[model samples]
Target: MKQVLVLGAHGQIAQIVTKNLLAEDVQQKLFLRSSARLTVANPQKEKLIEGNALSLFDLQQAMEGVDIVYANLAGNVVESAKNVIAAMKAKGVKRLIWISTLGIYDEVPGEYGKWNHEQLDGGYLETYAEAAQLIEDSDLDYTIIRPAWLDNQDEVSYELTRKGEAFKGTEVSRKSIADLVTKIIGEPSLYVRESLGVNKPNTDGNKPAWYR
Candidate 1:
């Protein structure tokens, strides 16, 4: 069974992924900044480790005896990615699945693209892009997921754009992101060393639906 280590396990997307992990026959290690924040019932089934993703010592401890690392980390993400990469290398872990955003690539088209840069350029988009670069340059087998603006919808419907293509649509359900992560965990070879853009099918508009 694949022993999976989840970084930033408390985030919305990671929480959904954590719930799904319980159903799989895999050993899960959840790494969070504080142990008190973990509220999952029957939590004994999974290993819960408290640590900062940016701390090499913390990450190294969390990554021990792991096979795949699912990084749901944010905030100073480029530095976080660097720390993760270093820790993974130290542990000799091979696969990494990282969450990124679509606008980082400037792949959202026309007015939407303009709006994306205007809103996120100096903020999330910049750091996310740098983080992607760090992961892409690393030797570890990796899949960087760039999802459109996220929502709390219940279903898993979604679509994708390969690297270099304009990202389609404006928003995707958080559940959709979780489902994709589950799929990748089940089949580690799928999309190795690739960065993918995900969105809901036919949802493309001048901007996100909520913006209208």
Candidate 2:
């Protein structure tokens, strides 16, 4: 059984994915800035590591013995990507599942595309795109997951788009992204060195429903 290190363990999606992994054969090293806030479900199976993604030392510590890394992070993502790649190289961990946002490639189409820019333009979209570029340029087996506008709906419904293909639909449940993460963890060979755009099947709109 391979151990999986989950960065940004405090995030909503990370927490959901961590909980899902708990039931599987994988041992989890949950890494975050503050560890005390996270309650370990299985003491023997989950190890809460207190650390920040921006620190290479902390990331290396968490990467110790981790076979796969699932990073669900926010804030200064470009620096985070650099530190993550450095730490993984140092620790010789290959596989990475990174959470990113839509429109990074300007792949979103039509009215929804314009709306996406309206919401995520300026610093947010640009920095994420830079971070993603760093990952793609790395030698690691990385799967970059770009999910559509997220919601808390309790369903797993999503479709995927390759890097060059235009993005599809509008909104997708957080559960859907988590399910994809769970699936990739179960089988590391699922989407290696690929960028995937995840969205709901029929959610095409100018923007997410809550905003419209």
Which one wins on TM-score?
2
lDDT of 2 by residue, 69-97 (tens): 99999999999999999999999999999
RMSD of each: 1.1, 0.7
* Top candidate when judged by lDDT against the true structure: 2
- lDDT, each prediction: 0.90, 0.95
* Clash pairs, model 2 backbone: none
lDDT of 1: 0.90
Q: Given candidate 1, what's the lDDT at residue 76? A: 87
User: What is candidate 2's TM-score against the reference?
Assistant: 0.99
